[model samples]
Target chain A: MILAATPGTATLLVELGVILVGLALLGRVAARFGLPSIPLYLVAGLVVGEGGVVELVTARTFIESGAQIGVILLLLLLGLEYTGEELTDALRDHAPAGGVDLALNFTPGLLLGLVLGWDVRAALLLGGITYISSSGIIAKLLADLGNTGNRETPVVLAILVAEDLFMALYLPLMAGLLIGGDALDIGLEVTAAIVAVVTALGLAVRYGDRISQVVFVRSDENLILSLLGLALLVAGIAEHLQASAAVGAFLVGIALNGPAEHAARTVLSPLRDLFAAMFFAFFGLQINPTDLPPVLAIAVALALVTAATKLATGWWSARQVGIDPPGRLRAGATLIARGEFSIVIAGIAVAEGIEDDIGPLAAAYVLILAVGGPLIARAVEPLTRRFSQLGRPARPRRTPTARGTTVS
Target chain B: MTEINETKLPGVGTLHDFESQSGGRIGVIAHHADRREVVIYDSADPDRVSEGVTLTAEEARTLADLLGGTSVTKRLDDLRQEISGLAIDWLPISSNSPYVGKTIGETELRTRTGVSVVALVRGDQPLPAPGPDDELRAGDTAVVVGTAEGIDAATELLTARAR
Candidate 1:
């Protein structure tokens, strides 16, 4: 009998299985070394990428599109977890110092991009992309380090919330500019976004309790389906309005925040996690190995500068706001990790042809940040302790509580 | 005398005792006196009580009453006592108020409001671990803890001075 060729479906199944197994093994190894598993996952993607021995993911467009969805869902979860009060608190806490941090990180990236002969739009995109610290990696590392309940967790979360809010506002504006759309069109888009958000909030306020009681209380399956449906519908509407689908998804998540919805998140989380993994894997597939060495060098350099600037800016801000030395150091170290959203911005830039060459660079930067950011965060405790000893007498230790614990 | 003698049982408080002893029990007792108890006894044949041992009219009536009524007044009273200590009062800072963006120490809030800012519920986040320098933002709901007068003063100041 003639040997049957491996069908695309079978090949995909085999590749996915191998990639997942490799990722799990690598993640375990990384955990043993006290590093976050995200870096391992990224490395695994690199191994199975086109440049590596195996070619598991060959379609860059499909992978990128899937990754984009992952980022949208990630942002939606973030919005769901935070409310207007929480968001405002984050802004207040970070506004005084985050402004400086943003400037320091953005300025260097902009200068570098310009020096490299990049266009204005490209330079700004690069700058903005580099300016953000990976909140996801940092938060994960903090939890891993058993600092999730630390007093500084909320502060770091607040800072991240501020950064994300800025990103949500900035992304659409950037898209409008690069699309060469008219001012009136952009204005109308912005107004429509505002109206959509208000309507979503109004629906949430009016019907949230009843909806939660029916959907979540009745059965978890219903809750998951309803939430997923809401996310997709909102994203679809956002696309229709020519705004970022991620922004719409985020607004829906924000509107859903309450005790009843919070309970339902646990059931829905596994699905989000699955999609999120696929998203990161897709991002990994987009890297062209031949372009990596030079891009990696730039990524490392930019990551270093961004981390330093973020730390210094965060520290100074915390100090200005009268945070203790330990608290400031913790905040500084924690704010250094950057992840999916940065890549999304880079991908957007590529899609719009604003600076096609910068996508790989931005992706490389995210990879570097994901790898190195956790290491810096892990060192914060020892560093803070050392600095606290050198400084004035340490402040009286507060008893640990749930509401404002510091994450590593 | 019979009622008094029948009121005591291990793990059975005044509420349960009253319900057991009366068809419909209703009464109050000192909080501390209602604490849980444990009973221990040695019996050659513990199950013999159900084998038709003769009992006086008083004993039969007490047992019958104990099986009749249903009352969980003790638990309800405990819940009430716990809730009484959790009074929360909100303070508003009016638009023309002088306390905008000021810290607790800067505003001398303790002196002016006569209430301790136990927590700050700003939007969706609650600052249960608020520091002395945590600046007050507009529309912050300060969870003040104090007497009625203190709560009123804090509320008035918040209303008068909040941005």
Candidate 2:
């Protein structure tokens, strides 16, 4: 039995097993502190990656492929989260807020990229990295804090939805731009990418019911198999057409609804989580630890500036919806974290060789915000109360009455 | 009736809230995954919840039943302890089902399937001991009690688009 096995099989199995167990432990540590697991996963990758510590030979291939699938699954599930109606409604109701968000957040990273003397393509990619907040982290934070029912939670969610919808357009355009060519070639490619996205969105809106019907099956196993198969197929075709595969997976997610969407979410969630972990870790693995020190200051400065801008955007939007001061603060604090999507932007740029510094900068930037955002959100309320007391005499804190229950 | 306001939480679910006559704010978050939470907002700050309580799917059902009226139908939990192989299920009426516009009497549900329709929920209202002439509409949920097999048979009959 031992001789029949491949030469390096035991080593491969052992390395993969060790890495996965490490990730599981890191996940538990994050959970203990009520924090998002993403930053820790990235840190784990950094520790084991090149220039840090031990390196894997065989597992590297698995991590690379797993990361690609992870990106696809991430975008697909993000798309699945919103219905067409929600997207349109959010765009209409909060378009101004979305505009403000883009302006406030995108400019900082763009400027940072330009100041560093990077190319326009790389600068634009940085702008995108700064623009999108992590809906995944924020949603989990709100639920954990019991703030889902808060008045300003919808405002926060609406902003997130608008950003995601915008990404549906931005990603394809970036995909085209990333493929270098002459001016005319780039223009044509970009147009084609935009057209593909538009056509996909239109089909999702018009024929989504039919698409869902085609994908849905009684058996959970078959349902996942078909959904996964369809996503990979569309992603492949889109990639072939110079449209980003992520956009195609996203469009696939947008097209599913009704019972099919529900079942798909149920089955795909765990699979998405596993692959997504690999994706983040792989991102961390790409950056050399030594490259991090030079860019760490810049990353810290960029995170601070963007966090402030996110606060302002959230506050303004909440005010537009007539939310009070405390609610506005909650809304602002909620949007401060930049997570998966930011890394995704940097990952694209890194893969395309946009700039050497981008990978380290983005990894450090995301790590700070991902860890700090939640702490800031938790602290905002107490800080405000403290400041209020300092300005005036302290009033007796009112104990919440349990008498709110209705007997009728 | 208090005016209930509904807000859509983009990636989460829907939130429906209302202010009580005493000026207290109460809300429910209905998650897409069938999870439910009851939240009471802080009187001092409407932006925060003073208390939040999560409910299991069954607990949510019981809460709805209690709010609507005293549920005369046997509680599933109580019945489970008393008998083996007995079941109670809440089955939804889909719009495409053939029985959507038909009266409860027309299906001959109890006579044919041995499953009794104990209560029917329409909109936010619960109808306990619905009469034979009561009409079944799309989106209404019917509570039925019987053996496990009978419930399955009844579910098929109610959900099937064709006889």
First chain TM-score for all predictions: 0.84, 0.94
Residue B45 CA displacement from its true place in model 1, Å: 65
User: Per-residue lDDT tens digits of candidate 2, residues A201-307?
Assistant: 98897788999988899999999999999999999998898888888999999889888899999999999999999999899888888999999999999999999
Question: What would the per-residue lDDT of candidate 2 be over residues B59-104, giving only the tens digit for each residue?
Answer: 9988988786344343431233215877888888999888998999
DockQ of each: 0.02, 0.36
TM-score of model 1's chain A, to 2 decimals?
0.84
Task: List TM-score per model, in order.
Answer: 0.64, 0.81
All candidates' chain B TM-scores are 0.43, 0.50
User: Fnat of candidate 2, please?
Assistant: 0.75
Q: In model 2 chain A, where is the ten-residue run with the lowest total lDDT?
A: A386-395
Q: Name the top TM-score candidate.
A: 2
